[model samples]
Target: MTEDTLNSASIGAGALLSVLREGPARTRTELVELTGLARTTVSQRLDALLRHRWVVAADASTSSGGRPAATFAFNRAARLVLAADLGATHHRVAITDLGTTVLAERTADVPIDRGPESTLAWLAQTFTELLAESGYDLADVCGAGIGLPGPVEYLTGRPVNPPLMPGWDRFPVPEWLGERLGVPVLVDNDVNIMALGEHWGGHWGGHWAGYPEADQLIFVKIGTGIGCGIISDGRLHRGAQGAAGDIGHIRVAAADDEVVCHCGNTGCLEAFAGGAALAARITASGVLAKDSRDVVRLLGVGDPEVVHLVRQAGREIGDVLASIVNFFNPGAIVIGGDIAEAGEHLLAGVREVIYKRSLPLATRHLRIQASKLGDRAGVVGAAVMVIEHVLAPQAVDTTVTV
Candidate 1:
């Protein structure tokens, strides 16, 4: 390694831990060489990590001859994270290792509008059940993350004036869950966590498997409402007030003025294209579609009118996303949620408008595709969010010091 390169590498225990997380194992000499730190300095950092069980020494040696050299690897199983994906109509909870691998998970139709106290009580109980099912306990949990289907004040982990989430305004989500779970809790919008899951956790393999690794990506969820999560330079961009991706409420150009939105807006994109809106349209057509899931089921049954409406809904969503594509110029846009599960018709409409309306430079390398993870995206993303926060450099340093 170059002297300048060696000089630039951080020599902290957290820095070393970050390298170890990249996989494989390294000996103390290799760690010194890679981190560009003195042998004694490397030993000190490694000792701290080993003491905290953040890194473990392999039993085998990596030596050609003479004294055996010990190897160290990041202990991905050192802690667990409890993650919950709470939608307006459904919720899911999971227990994952530090690596974001789901060890145990459960999903139910418990609605979010049940109010924070009741919903969170159910969540806390479910988390306990999942941990025990996974052979772990609250003590093994490092942190918890939740993705709500509404606006959230990310810094405080509280919902803020969410339209669909009645009785959840300014609710202390983190505090309520943390008090029960005995760990730090983090909360964010459902689509944001889906974006994180689409970006960080991928147990599903499909055509768009390659998109999650993109540094700049957009994840659009078209369920009861339409929203997006932006990934800029490989990190979630929550904007000021954690409301950056509330694309559904944006006024749609040339939208029907008569279409009313739950937020009391007349021309909002969600009023025209969201799942609830589509379901209402289906109901008007004499078909019974309770929600977005019903819309997908109707699409499965080849209901011609539902198909037409879903495609048109996709077009309306695309109309709004075209401007987003031009402005953000993301590397990829992943489509998810119940409406998206309606299949390729939505994607076709979206691709048609996006490719036609977006600037050439933006469209040149942009990929618009379906979410591989599908319904599991939210829960997986929730786990990933917790894993990143719990194992962050500052958190790691604090853990070692503590």
Candidate 2:
């Protein structure tokens, strides 16, 4: 069935989820209004939730008239979803309760580029080790969400022509990992996971908190490569070809006109701003150690040359972001990656151009901010891609009018 045509139980579950998410159903009236479900259905689902310990009967209501009915809220400690972000150099695994409160997290420097077979084995082993260490057994876990640094067809749970990570093209990641881990798996692009982490974890600069809702967020990654995640209207916009935000492949001007990219294209965005380019610029500068993170470290020391390169990269990125802001008009832009570690040096360049080039009407309320999640953003974004998979409603296949 379509997302809009969920069965009665799913609807009831949806209603219960709404209440659980909001954390209060003190009265049946509130439950009815919040879920749009029939009162009886809400009651039944809530009963099931209560039985499952997902909800609990809390304090009593005021005794103004007669005996007050007790209020209920979600039991956050009842269930947990593990979020795993798989990266080329390292992996981050976190255990989060239903409320998104992380209980225990583990990090490993296991190389993810060692092919999917070996990497999945390491990942499964890490999960097992983490569970054992945290006293959180497999039975207590609700599900596992994983994020990868590649384009993923969520419906098929496979990478599609992932440019950087070889031997992972159209790889059956979720299926393979699920069979070994014995948990329902959800997977998506790494950038998508970071966007969710920023939204859920209070990382959107804390200035725009609760203003525009978590709907229309743009998280841009500028690291070993560039990628992006677009969360519009509170949903990930994968678009046709699953390349909606694959701006890394977009052609851009490079210092060397002859610079070739892995995608067999000249002067693509990644060739300009990816981790390699950042290092190449620094290495060619003859004044730095030729590392992006070191450039970030040196930028912190006010090195003019490194700062200039990072800002230049930011401006180039902003040149591209300008086209996107003109088209999408996202509420906020989160700069994430090693270059983003330079903070305002990079963000100022982006904001300068985005505001200068984009139409005034389109950028009316646009706010650009450095990613509060930083390097962790990708890994976290990766995990979120997976969590959003089955947690979300199926495609409605019907037009929705704002």
Candidate 3:
């Protein structure tokens, strides 16, 4: 029978699963009350969920009189999610449970420009190895999430004219990878997933926890290139064409016509402040640094010129963020990527500009700090993306039946 034919008392298995996913196991009576389903309907749906291993019997509920009622909880371990964070020069793959907890992970220096065929082939093989290593197989993985270091159309999961990723433009990432892994896949820009990782993972510079104001947050990644992931009202806001937080192209006061950006723009923020810019400047000064990682190493060795360059980049980035703070007024601005390794040197410059240029009210409770998740943010966020999608109520409704 069609779902529309069911009576109001015949609640779907997904609705019951959603309530249990909120934590704290509930008994049959509680599930009936919470979902407004008849006791028999709740019991039937709960039985189906139990048969599917989506829900499991937990400790019985305490009672003042008679025997305790059996309770059921969301079975987070019932399935797994494969997550991949592919960068310009590196890639990290992880296997996580339905709860987004990492079960196995692997990392390597795999370049994106190597083309999608080779890169994705390596990813597919690596996922197989990771699943085996974690004592699981393809059947256990519910879905996969990938974060590419370029512009990805959220609806199509295809890279559209990604400058760094030449061969990946408009490639069918989800369908291609999903075929290899035998599960559904989701893809998004790297910065967007990093933002999800930072915000959902709740790493606020240090061990700070229980941040109630996290509904509005921004994650800024200052690596070889600069970009931001916006969290508006507790959701990742991928704007029209999935380019909402492309702050790197924004023009800044410090930039001049002489500062040409790779995107064919003059005096853009990234031209003067991205890690590539600092590396270029340092190399031009006869430092022989190859990339952003080399620039960080120079900072570690107390290279005054490199230190000055990084701090200046931070200031340039902050100058752009100041306008964002005033306009968006996010609860926090999290700094991450390879450059964040420079520690206080980078943060000091960013804080200096944001606090000085932003409005008093905007900067009053603003938190500008380093990322606590560091390099792992991308992979963790990728897993979070898949977990949320596969376990969502609608998807669950299709997977489980009463």
C-alpha RMSD of candidate 2: 5.0
How far residue 350's Cα lies from its native spot in candidate 1, in Å, is 0.4
Question: Higher lDDT: candidate 2 or 3?
Answer: 3
Task: Give residue 38's error in model 3 in angstroms.
Answer: 1.8
lDDT of 2 by residue, 361-389 (tens): 87887878887766556545544454444
User: What is candidate 2's CA lDDT for residue 363?
Assistant: 83
TM-score of each: 0.94, 0.87, 0.94
What overall lDDT goes with each candidate model?
A: 0.86, 0.72, 0.86
Q: Please report the TM-score between candidate 2 and the true structure.
A: 0.87
lDDT of 3 by residue, 140-233 (tens): 8888899998889999999998877887889999889888888988999999999999887784233446665667889998887889999998
Model 3 Cα shift for residue 183 (angstroms): 1.0
RMSD of 3: 3.6
